[model samples]
Target: MATAIRRLLTAAVLLAAAAAAPARAGTLPPLVDVAWLEARLGDPALLILDVRGPLDGEDVVPFERAHIPGSVHTDYLKDGWRTTVEGVPFVLPPVDRLEVLLGDLGIDETRTVVVVPYGSTSTGFGTAARVYWTLRVLGHDAVTILDGGFLTWRADPARPVETGPSVPEPALFEAKPRLDWVVDTREVERALRDDAALLVDARPEDQYAGRTVKPGVQAAGHIPGALNLPESVFFVPGSGRLKPVRELAALVPGTVRGFAGPIITYCNTGHWAATLWFVMHELLGMEDVRLYDASMVGWAADPKRPVERAVPASG
Candidate 1:
């Protein structure tokens, strides 16, 4: 009982802080802000990636022409680091395919790749978060997301953006799944029953209520006992900055409600879940956080599983 109270108190404190704290407009680790990015524009070990995919715009090169200087181009929407999921559209690729793809992008275990998306939309950061989750799942921790995202950088014309692609020698990015970084459908099966795991759905309410399950998924509901906390909830609108830690506590109830030590975030395709990963793992300073890489598409596809459209019982 004491432990539960303590966790609840901790969560409350986090949320309060988040709500009260001043807005910090930027990314995690305090290293991805514009000042930081500006300072490291020419660093060798750091690799900048303009991952604005084939956006609905006028021309390709035209967009690339106005990117952050020294930033390389990669269609965050196109060049996927994944392959067949046996069923789903955005399933994670095999380890080998992922490694080869990263290598081709000139990314290796050593390079500190900073992803740049087109706008502050969750879509852009979602893409970056997905890649970040991939690296973490593959066992690399040197990754970081641009807090304010690409549009923030471009908003300032004085800032530099190169016109072409930047390529590097293929580097070996090894894969050693930190199973703890992610939880699969089977694990969710058990974790749902376990009081220790906080099942957080990073999707919006409509999806949680059995509306948008995405194509190919067998169901529209959510994992039984999961809470609907969309990934966008944590962000300070327009800025990539997350809500203050304390403030988030109020918005996101902690594991105190008979919940467990760590939190697991999930969405239909594992995309929005990555945003939650950034919020919980990096912003709120929660270490025992994991992203459901397979998410709902992987979970509901199996006929053996059952989903719940209503809010889980807190009692």
Candidate 2:
């Protein structure tokens, strides 16, 4: 049909653009602005992965409607990006499956991937952080997150937008999982017992104080000895962009800011924790930070695990 032919032609054009794109010179930063991305739109080594989905009531923008030219669309929430492991939701999937998913998206070790989120709320921005964390865990260091995300890109009407889904030219992607980047429940338990790592609870104050609990999590409070540092504080008010380093440092509590040990971030699931991990590990250059991928959902599933309830210090 005509429609099918048009799609094929569009794919051909995108592939051609990618093929002709110039090789990028240096390592890509962990975060890139709209201007930075626009300048390298057609880079063959760059993969613009639009991970827009319904996070925090933001409606999904169909790829057929508008997207960055030569970009591929992948729903971060609905996709197999996260899987349930041992009844713990939002856990990272096995390495083999991740390899298939990335390979299908035409992502490989050589490609510098840019994850694009909806850029409406902190929760939405977390989606990008989660994906960015996943890539790093898979030993793919050539990944970056788009600051201000897709909304920032659309803010200027002059910016080019492409319609219809981009057909990716599949490449073989191999996974080299970084076991140290993620910690399991037993590791967390050991850390709690030995006080080896700084447990930073990323849930809101209410949740940390046992005032509210996320529905699948059996517990009503955070883990023992964990300090509450809500993920929202890391972002600019009413925006997806993260606050400047100085502003972020000012917001961080003295306990966390002064600590010089291994840090672990956790939330209801690993979703919000990824944001904290990105901030600490990627932004703050803290090398020893790890993500509790199973987080509270997995920890609380066992009633034997001690959950602490305490009033967080007034800011």
Candidate 3:
């Protein structure tokens, strides 16, 4: 009983602080740490979106068990974040659907959204990145991701965690879609034909080399002229956290670093490609970086499209 009272008192203090705080304006960073979040706990303009889900053998922890105070929960995998359109799986949902989803979450242009993932693996981090990309493509610039996610937040015992569900008051969320941030198969073909954009394949080397293929994708190799750079390299070794900016820049090949053309990133289902897109577009601040959301699955569905297999060097 005493513990419950203490928790309530902590929440009250945070709420009071938030009510007294002045509104902040200006651009938000692409990523924020636990310390930065903890300081802004009760701010009314801040909305903490906890997107925890089953990924990489980790069981989903119920939001009622424990979550950051004032944070809302949404399952990244099961939620209507992505949908199939014209047989292409995992493509962005329609604008009206996205508007309803965001509005239901009490997300509007006035609030700054912070997306938190499970942060257990690189794939798990991709969930947050994918959501971030969705928001950016929707023309929402007041968004940022929680680096290291809930795992890092839970690592510290000093941070206050609340139990029970959080219900947000619904708000009107308008969608302002940005066509340039997303590219279609026709656009990709045109770019390839014109040698206009640098295509990047964010898949494992074996898959990129045609040695392995995913289940749903029809092709066994990468898009022709695409450079292979697996998304795993962006994360720190054995952790979900991203590497420092300088280190991340160093990982890019000289060819990619020197290329001045627009860049298009893709993977099997556009899941992994979202991470690469986040790194290049958001973290690196590269201009004209776009995501081929349909990715290999859509590309290979057309048998007429060309696929390339990297020739192995002779021993």
Candidate 4:
């Protein structure tokens, strides 16, 4: 009881601080709307990163053409943020490599970094979430995603944009790893039997049901007892923004209510699952959310691990 009360008090204090100073943002909550970002445009401590690029085509041409003023572009796909380890795709890179990557982009301990996705689709937005997760894992807490990303910024005529290259003055980046935010394949296996932890499959129903799959993953379906909640449901179709809170609350129904247990989110390679983790942990302020970085690619590769698909029961 004492521990519960202490946690509640800590959360209350955080809420109070968030309300008191909105400008000192980007740490606890991992999202910021365009309006908030527009107001803080010229702050010296702000680092805007445009992570817009195709997986395999073009340089930073799209980002070079026009971007938020003073914003630098990093190709999230090609960059070493996610790497292959012994044949697994989209796994987090080594800590030393990540520190240098962020340092080269002029990111440091003091800067409030806001990652901007292209915002074309829910899948596109996952890039921003992955980057946000990486920063948090590296122990840089002052990072958030531009909620609507570059599309919403471009929609408003008053928002200023700049073209051409931006050469950021590199800063030293140090990594203080937060091991709690991540869960490996072994931990996930344990969570399968632990009722206190909920295993959420963030892939679409087709993939979840073993009807379809993306390339490079060995599995056909999902882990046993995992619930399917596709990432697309979180975003509004035409608006290029997340649905309002009331609407978002209705989508998952009783799934999250009164459940203070840990949520472990995963997809084929941890890409799509990042979106669900962002919504549950960052947007909704759920305290215990962890991403399974190896995801199904790792889970399914081993024949000893169990996998499941939906099947009709006998009438």
Residue range 1-315, candidate 4, lDDT tens digits: 998995685556445434433332434356778988988999999999888778313332387788899998887877698898787778998899999999999999989898998777777688888898899888888988888888889888888999898788899999999878898888988877666588888998899989997787787888888888888898898443677654554555346533678889999889889988877776655668899999999899898899898832422
- The C-alpha TM-scores of every prediction are 0.82, 0.89, 0.88, 0.86
lDDT per residue (tens digit) for residues 1-315 in model 3: 998995675555444323322221144678889999998999999999988777634564677898899998777667789899998988999989988888888899999999997777888888888888998888887898999988899999989889998798899999889968888899999999999999999999999999999999898998888998999999988777898765676676657755798899999878899999887767765666899999999999999999998743432
Q: What residue runs in model 4 are displaced by over 4 Å at the alpha carbon?
A: 1-29, 55-61, 194-196, 238-240, 311-315
Residue 133 local lDDT, model 3 = 90
Give the candidates in order of TM-score, highest first.
2, 3, 4, 1
The CA lDDT of each predicted structure is 0.69, 0.84, 0.84, 0.80
Alpha-carbon deviation at 28 in model 4, angstroms: 6.8
- Minimum summed lDDT over a 10-residue window in model 1 is located at 19-28
How does candidate 1 fare on TM-score? 0.82
What lDDT, from 0 to 1, does candidate 4 have? 0.80
lDDT per residue, candidate 1, 1-315, as tens digits? Answer: 998998777766676444432232223352266777888888878878666664323333345457777667666556775444666567677778877777777777677778765654665677777777787677766667676766777778888777665655667767777667767777777876665587888888888889666776689888887788887777677544555555555565645223546788889878888877766666555557887777887888786787887766554
Which run of 10 residues does model 3 get worst, by summed lDDT? Answer: 16-25
Error of 3 at 117 (Å): 1.1
Winner of 1 and 2 under lDDT: 2
lDDT comparison, 1 vs 3, better candidate? 3
Candidate 3 regions exceeding 4 Å error are 1-26, 311-315
Model 3 lDDT on a 0 to 1 scale: 0.84
